[model samples]
Target: MSFPDEILIAGSGPAGLTTALSLHEAGFKVRVFEAVPEIKPLGVGLNLLPHAVRELDELGLLAPLAAAGVACHELAYFTKRGERIWGEPRGLAAGYQWPQISLYRGALQFTLLNAVKTRIGADRLHLGRQLTGFDATPGHGVRARFLNRATGHEETADGRLLIACDGIHSAARKIFYPTEGPPRWNGAVMWRGVAECDPVLDGHTMIMAGHTRVKFVCYPISSQATRPGAQQLNFIAELRYDTTELSEREDWSRAGNLADFLPQFESFRFPWLDAPAMIRAAPAVWVYPMVDRDPLPRWTHGPVTLLGDAAHAMYPIGSNGASQGILDARVLTGCLRHHRADPEAGLTRYDAIRRPATTQIILSNRQQGPEACMQLVEDRAPNGFQKLDDVVSRAELDAIAAKYKQLAGFAIQELNTRPSLASPTA
Candidate 1:
């Protein structure tokens, strides 16, 4: 028999799926609504920091992540001409109990989705349902409306709480901040793609080359054996424009024109990898304007609140786009479990813990976060440095990295010892 306390989840992406899984583990009923008719592996590569990996490990997904993705060994920064500026051990190499992972964004989403379906039942996830509006009746909980895309009819579902994990264009968020316009652009556009290629440095390294304006990010996401010794390489080509206006809204499926950004990166040839050859190898490319919303003063309004991108959408810098969303899911779940008697209090507490944290990330990413080193190198030694120390010291580089890890809640020492976020231990 279904109870009146069932949780209603809007959006079935990683955060939403994870939310349902966590709630189910704590003996709460959850139903997820998604706008997409079919959930397929979409989007390019993303990295999971140790903090985010810890949450997934709690959900019993560490093994699957390793099977489908690469356990990143190191991360490095370089000049546009490919001169190394800074490099450091990453994931387990950096001494965290959890390993940082690099994988296709779709892979991680499905990992969480599959877990939810098996544990919460496939029927719990309602596809083609777009969240339109929601009414939260203080103590009684929420009654939400949705547009059933397949049938083209409005439907309603009542639940004890509503969590909106919808993406940046979240319908629920729009309702709360109707005066807010489209996502704010940062004058940069990214062309992302994955290709089969030989390993660059260690077969498991993530590298960011170039500076803030024009940059190239590449890493081996998986070793799925494309050829005799080839692995799938994920790369992003970013360029800053004088104008901040994005004619087309961001879409992961939008195909990019080769002539648009290839020439800018063709000259990035290095002994470790050929620049032009790798770009030409990809089957297709997707484009997105670097955009994010100003952090809202609040995320919870009675029994209805937001999570993931709907709550905090930061720039891709610092590899926290999806990682932070994963953290939000776990933290929010822990809060809800602690305040089971008063679910409204749970929503308020979650907003207090997560909103301020992600707000800092949003502002830091605008300044390039730890990636500021790339821009600094470009400023001081644009002509290429004979010695990287002359451009920036190891102490300066380490401090920048440490500060970001602390802010992002993944400093090696802290993350290794931080207590588990999932309640009932999955």
Candidate 2:
């Protein structure tokens, strides 16, 4: 088969947009198809680890991203009783060349979308095109079929390569893994919201309290909440319920009621911050099950492949989901650059390099990832702790943190020394 010219990208989320940007920068023609008719600043906050931030920096997006979100300074873990379990400097504070960022998921998407349009041109992006299916033409490229959600029209486009970044419910993924059902639920439900509140700690610290069964995570996503001494805080209150089955649809925008989970944190007031107050002050709360899919043995088939959540959906335990997807975009682009003469070879190399790397993260997240520190403290000292060392040693905590960083491909020294994933020409 002969190498074709343009690449077809499905979904306009972070993964797809980043992939489009990277390929376009490498002097490749690319087009992105998004299911949403229009992009909006929707969804809550997300973290971009230092490694992921490095990729964004190479794309010349660091300035806009820093403007949209807070550069996190520290990550601390605490118990339900409001006692600190572990604390460590993060991002630049941790000596990384890049800083870890906390920003709204929608803001990140829109930023990437704008970058794509500015670089690749607006005509290359096809909105309201919901991917229904795709086919690989024998001696030609892949033919992707889409349903125009706006006009009820069917459309078909052909590309040399088809990259699926359509997210968890990706139609392309379904076609590949036909037997796979809905995402596997881990019996936990998460209620997320953002509130304008006084800065807790340093105003740039990310905190995770409680254990696996019941937990609370809070951090500021933006600096827009300038009410004298207040900042915009994004938070998630998660609880593992009795039923293992997912009762409601897995929608990110599903409305949630405070009455259901408020009692659990009724007495969770602390000197620095009030968990209950933050939860109540939010304009709205969205509920979603903490779910992920079993890592697939393969992510490539001929010239078609998957990326981001479509390829590897892991629990949001360690803030690695979006970061991993960003890394996917970078590595895949580099592979394509190396194997441009043979698109199939590029797809295969991308799969070989990313599949195993993300599979480990998927399994690690299932074991709670770095959040294991919180659970360990909870298990060792269910009531409370006089001194953290008395319950768990410093060495144990250090080991947990180090292992996770290494597994997530963000070990401080390693990340600093690693070469950029950008194509040589780029």
Candidate 3:
């Protein structure tokens, strides 16, 4: 069994596409498969953290991304009562070499898709090819089977490696661990929607609101919409609930009724933004359990492996869900580039570096994610705080915030001081 230079990637989302583009740039022949008949703009907002930005920057994509996205400068935490709890600089303002971006998920995906097409050619992407199964060929490559969505006919493809970026509920992951069960819900049901609203706060600030029982967060994803003063703002309404049922673990397009959970936000009227009005005016709403799997011990099996959500789907609490996936693509590409002589060694190295890093984030997101600052302030003053200083000291809040930055592996100082991934071991 000999390793080939070509790889077959399962999934057309950010992780798979990014991996394909990067690997192509590294001199690897890449092919990508998507389960959908046609790729449509699904899902809502996602943040492009600095770490991810660095990867895109290296790929010469920063300008195109900046043209299509909004650069966020700060993230603010406030109580439902409209009191500012904590605020920190974001993106380049936070001293990172790269800036942070917030945009519609579809816009980002399309941007990456376009880039991949430009670099690797449109023929590289195969739509309507749902990855069904795969097997390692003795010691070196993977033979993958797929069900064509349009023809309903079977197809087979072979490559030196198979990557499952198929996302959460990944068919590739299921093939590996069939009995692992559905993604474990974190006891928090979240409803998301985009609102056409005027600038809130600094307009670029991402805000976290409410407490554990009735927490909500919103931020402006775009400033230029059809009407003036109407920005495309994204909001997420989360509440604690039992998650034993696995009936609603559908894809991102699952529709949610406003009445199902609007009662909690009925009274949530803040001076900066009217919560109920925004929710009501939204033309579309998506609902999903704020859930993630406990980190896996490893993501590699022979020539087949996992990447992105298929690898480590974590709570979106820290705004690292998509960014982490992009990071995985970059690191995996780095490994593959360095060890092309033995591609299997590259897969093993990718696992060694990223599995532990992402595993730490998965567990941290469950325990004390970036939202911990808001949680601490809310817990101290449930009703209302007479004074911000009395409710929680600035030092305490800063420490909590800094800890999350470190854990998420994007602390500006740490990244600057540490050696790059190319320098043997980082």
Off by over 4 Å in 1: 1-3, 423-426
lDDT value, residue 148 of candidate 2? 100
Misplaced by over 4 Å in model 3 are 1-3, 416-426
Candidate 1: give the clashing pairs: none
Give the alpha carbon lDDT tens digit for every residue of 1-426 in model 1: 232798999998878888888778877899999999999999989999999899889888899987889999999998899888888899999999989999998999888888888888999999999999987788887889999999999999999899999989999899999999899998999999999999998898899999988999999888887488789999999999999887877887889988999999888898987867888999998888899999999999998999999999889999999889888988888888888888888888889989999999999999999999999889998888788888889999998898898999998888888788755221
Candidate 3 Cα deviation (angstroms), residue 195: 1.2
What are the TM-scores, per candidate, against the unseen true structure? 0.98, 0.98, 0.96
Model 3: colliding residue pairs? none
* Model 2 C-alpha lDDT versus the unseen true structure: 0.91
Candidate 3 C-alpha lDDT tens digits along 334-409: 8887877777778888999999999989998888487787778778888988889998888988988888888888
RMSD of 2: 1.6
Pick the lDDT winner.
2
Q: How many clashing residue pairs, candidate 1?
A: 0
Q: Please give the distance, in angstroms, between residue 9's alpha carbon in candidate 3 and its true position after superposition.
A: 0.7
Model 1 alpha-carbon miss at residue 60, Å: 0.9
